[model samples]
Target: MTKDFTPPVRLDIDHLQSLYRSGGLTPRQLLDRLDDYQAAFTDRNLWIHYLTPDEREPFLQTLEGESPDSLPLYGVPFAIKDNIHLRGIPTTVANRHVRIVPDASAFVVEQLLAAGAIPVGKTNLDQFATGLNGTRSDFGPCGNAFDPDWISGGSSAGSAVAVALGMVSFALGTDTAGSGRVPAALNHIVGLKPTLGRLSVEGVVPACQTLDCVSIFARTAAQADRVLTLADRRNPTDAWQEHQQPPKRLMGQSFRFGVPAADQLGLVEYPEAQALFDATVAHLEALGGTAVDIDLTPFSEAAALLYDGPWVSERQLAINDLVNTPDQVHPVVRDVLSAGDQFTAGDAFSARYRLAALKRRTDAVLATLDTILTPTCPAPYTIADMMADPVALNARLGAFTNFMNLLDYSAVSVPAGFLDNGMPWGVTLFGPAWSDSTLNGLAGRLHHRVTDTVGATSDPLPDEQPPQPLRTLQVAVCGAHLAGYPLNHQLTDRGAVLVKRTRTAPRYRFYALAGGPPYRPGLIRTEDRGAAIEVEVWRMPEDRFGSFVAGIPHPLGIGQLELEDGTWCTGFICEPCGMDGATDISDTGGWRRYMASMATTETRQ
Candidate 1:
């Protein structure tokens, strides 16, 4: 070996990507260094199965022709929670009694691999993903990355540790409630939970199918953002998959953020977490977020529904035959799932109804704010403390998290500050559905403001880079290309942003295009028969405009259209021949409104 061939110890996506491009590192070299890193942290209990050279060769083979610039995750190594399948790997869900070797990767894992990411192993979890504390596993606990005596928050424990320990650039964990966030908080890493169904959960062993979200843990928010981008690609096979596009509402220069009213924060017993949260509020304000105190009663009630209410029955549905033999499960985990058998179908409906009411109330309150900030975990506990009273410790860890999936929101947990004892503390930025990117940007800007270290490592924080706006043309859109709509991601993924919203001039006709999966609309200029319609103007990169135009298929074409204010620009236009037998939708005035009416009409039919 060359004497000065230093390894790329900073395993961030951007850093490693740069090293790869500069010829400073190679995939083989990275694997060798990871071996040294794992050897140093010998007792962390972070893996259910770390891949051997033979096991990883197939993955490396897939990356032969990939380029990092094209596939941003090319050559990057990642780990998955045991509950999620990776083809040819055994998914045990942290239990030896239950082993399932899958022939297919989960939808998200397949997407990651296709984008050039390599899987190194599967990480340990709470048995069946049932506990927030890591100790319920037969493989033993995954201790805190900072302090071995402290608990490594679970049920995604080892996934977080693998990232914090620099074993991988990122790791995947399933978050039903707080499993994703708590572990990141304890490990001083970024935990990102997208909106429900945002990432396809197909092939993931669900704890609660309706609430499960495939989450990501990374050394920085930027890295997590990249993984989220890749994992959130459109999935056609997963029934739960939703086309969750980014929100368009801009926070502007000054944004409104909420916090639990003085007495509403549930951290009275954990003074350190409480202090850190208070400081976090101030930090948000410094970042141009106006902090407001709001009542957390409705949110707290919704959180209780996850475990205290009949939603426990969903756990019973997840593990088919495993529940038949409760002895095979951990005692506390079995105790929790046993309650599922006691709930009647009527109980499930009642709990759901109550949750709906709370969601309505939460929405009404949150309409006045951009996001709500809170401690990622209200209290940090030792492994002994969690084991002494399993159920209660888990609840405390989930205090600020369980309500998120229930309420259909998105969140990012980032390192806030360290506790006096040198353990890391963190806070979560949360908002309504489709706001994953918003919370991501805010969490990162806040992390840069508050911390200077990554995980338990002595390495310094990477240099912060300001976001650079793309050079784009201000193209007007009136249909599917609008933000949060079905096809909006095409614009967003290409660096487009919705800049202006307005109505078109009364010289165009709207028609519902024939044929569907992704239904679309077409507009045409007519001499006399026309109506002014709603439209959204987006700024798209000139370089991307050609590719965007190329994907317009046949019926729709790019052409000039007049806006309400007497301006003309290229927009959606339909070929007259393709309009045969198409339904006229000018009455609805816009594509979104037209689609809403079609849905309502279908429901009635």
Candidate 2:
């Protein structure tokens, strides 16, 4: 790189793709530049095993035929939390004693590599990924991106910092109780802990096997979503990858999101976090969401069970080989994992039963809203402060995250912003299993609502891409069903929203279909002589279209109708025979105006 040439501070996948597409850079040039970038941040503790160019030759050569347009992640550099396996590398879950050589990459890593992403190295993490604070590792804590004095948020800490500090474009992490999310919150990036089993956990070192979800960390929700689309697939061999289909899309752009009631949040002590959360709530409302305060009793209680109850037993099971030699583990992590051995089979069973009960109750509450929004971490803390009280501090970090897998939910953590002290914060959107796509859709929108710049860099987000309307069919309404009219509730109740209010092409004639008190109208396209009847276009979910059409009476049926802009849509049209008795209301532009005139005549009489 030239002395005058400034490298991209944030290797957002899109940014790299655009540069490659425009002939601004190549994979070879980027591979060379990675050396320069990594050299500048040598003290940040970002990696456990960064590969050299000679070591990276095979990985780079694998992208021989791929190009940006053909492969979504073409030439994008990435990192993996050391707990996840990469071929020919040692699988060190941040513990030197437990290192094991892996002959193959993990399932998700294979998929990403196949799509042309370059794996530069393996990153450091909390030993066995057993702590939320990044300080539990034997190698060193993955220090916070902003301040070495602060915590990076772990066990995905180094993965988050790797992306934030521009060492790599994105990274893979494991989330059991906010390991994936808290790091993103603190480091100013995006982390998506998808639905449990939504992405295969085949090669991941299990912290809590049943609860672990392979997660993606990137600079923006859009990049997280891109990685998610490629990674979410069923692995028949991996019992956790259950192959569940995602649920229906949230009604529309509008949604109702739940927040913990005041007493439950307990954020008064952290005024900055509290204020940022309040601002986020207001921001969601501004984006057309209805915020509902909820009783977090069940959720909070479930979070406690993760460490205080028998579920810690699963952590012990994950490292069965290391249990006898406790000295090899980090002191705090060893203490936590050792407690797991105290629970009896009966005790573990009892905890599972209680968790099931909580799941049922929490599921009911989730049903009332599209998502539950919470602070990714209650608050950020310094590395020194966390080390002083490792257990409680680590527990506080998982306050909002520990319940996710217990209840089987999907979540995305997006950057909220930095506070006066220069540390970043984040908010998460989560919902029932299979809500990944919907949650991400809202997450991307909410991300922009808080800040434009990605990660710790100064570059603003690229221009917003206009959302492509869902596959739902568009229908045009010319009568009582228009916005604020008598029958409009039917459309709204069925998840339909007004797209636009425009006019039909000049050749369409309108008629007041001589029906009862619940009146309606009909439109018909004529060859040459009629006005462009006023109409409103609405988009309805494809699933609801059949029932909506079934409700239409005999004379008026859905048929192709031309719009003022020459586009075609499904709209109410009358049968020729029915038009015989129908009174021509074409003189008025639309049914609403015609009805207004009738109301005036009645008042005059």
Candidate 3:
């Protein structure tokens, strides 16, 4: 082993790949250096089980003839939260009594392995994944990557610290309440809690089986997007898997985002936190986002339901046998699980009904905005402070995060800034399910604007290529569907936004179709005599295009129309049969002008 083996400054996927291509390092050399680093920090209790050299030999051997160009995660290293399974490794949920070795790796772990990512070890977590603070672990509490005195946040504690301290390129963690997000904010990294059921949970321990989601921790949001794209595969054996859906709403350059009303912020007590959140909102506005104040009553009520309501029963059911013998479990975890016993079936039903009603109201708020911005936690707590008041402090850490999975929203938590004490603070950008890619893209841009360094590393963030715009279909509207027209609501109601106002190619003739209460216009392609009719192009979500097309009446239908810019788009076109009784309005140049002419003629009569 090279005694002075200095690993890459940043363990992000891109930097590692560049180093490998330049022959500056090999996977074996880096792993050896990482082994040395892990040994140096053995007191942090970051890992429950670190793989030995012989145990990791097979993964290194598989990369012998493979090139980084051939694989997305080629030769990259990652950590797995202890609750997730790795073939033949002890699956400890921070509890020795319930540990078991799985015969097969998790569905997500297999996908990462196939893409050439090596797993170094399983990291520690809160016992049975119950608390939001890292202190309840049977393996000793994991500490903040920057300062051991502060709490590392919960359940996914070691996983976030690993990435923050540059132990691995990325790590896999699970988020039920706020396990995945809180840790990232405390440690200064990016944590992406995907839409519920977006990633398979097979071979993993369940916290809340129905609401559990696999999350990714990385130095940057771009890296998280890459990992999510690879791990998001359907698993036949996983009954809770949900397929990714096309976006229902579209976000543009200038978009509206929601912020909790002042009284609901939960940051007034901590002035530093409040100031940091204010700065975050201002930064987003600089990036062309408009802020809207929204009521957090429903969202806050739903968050309270996770722990205070009968949902605690799901935690008890996850490890019933172990809870029966409370001596084996951590005292805090045991107490939390025991609370499940008092709730009866009727209470569970009542909570479920209340949750449904809250979801409806939350959904209505989400419909009016592109995303919501909130501080990941109202404030950070010291490890000593957290341990002294574990339950309440843990609950406070989850204020902005606990409502995500319950409301079926996707969230990306990125470092916003650091507090005076040097501990990192972050903000979460969240939206409805299926908005994962958009949220990630926005998060990436915001992250680059705020900080150059990730975690405790001095290396600057890699320059990311501009993300491809969201998939949308553009349609040219000439009449009733144009902006401010009587039928314009039909377009806006389906999440369509105006792209620009331009003229159709000069090769089309404009017509005022013979119609009733609300008239319409059509454009017919003509060879010799035609005018450049003005049209407003609107971009609509692809998933909504089919329904929008289905609503078109007989005379005008969706067909290709050429624009003045020499581009073709789906637009309104007229069938030859419907033009028999139509008035030739080509001389008027557009529908709006023709309407003005008709009004003039009526006044003269």
Best-performing candidate as measured by lDDT: 3
| lDDT of every predicted structure (CA atoms) | 0.82, 0.83, 0.86
Q: Candidate 3, residues 7-68: lDDT per residue as tens digits?
A: 34458788899988999989998998888776765656889989998989989999899989
Candidate 1 lDDT score relative to the true structure = 0.82
- Give per-model TM-scores: 0.77, 0.85, 0.82
Candidate 1 global TM-score:
0.77
lDDT, candidate 2, at 506: 91
Q: Which pairs clash in model 2?
A: none
- All candidates in order of TM-score, best leading: 2, 3, 1
In model 3, residue pairs whose N, Cα or C atoms come closer than 3 Å (at least 3 residues apart or on different chains), thus clashing, are: none
Model 2: residues >4 Å from true position, as ranges? Answer: 1-10, 248-253, 321-324, 466-605
Error of 2 at 320 (Å): 1.2
Clash pairs detected, candidate 1: none
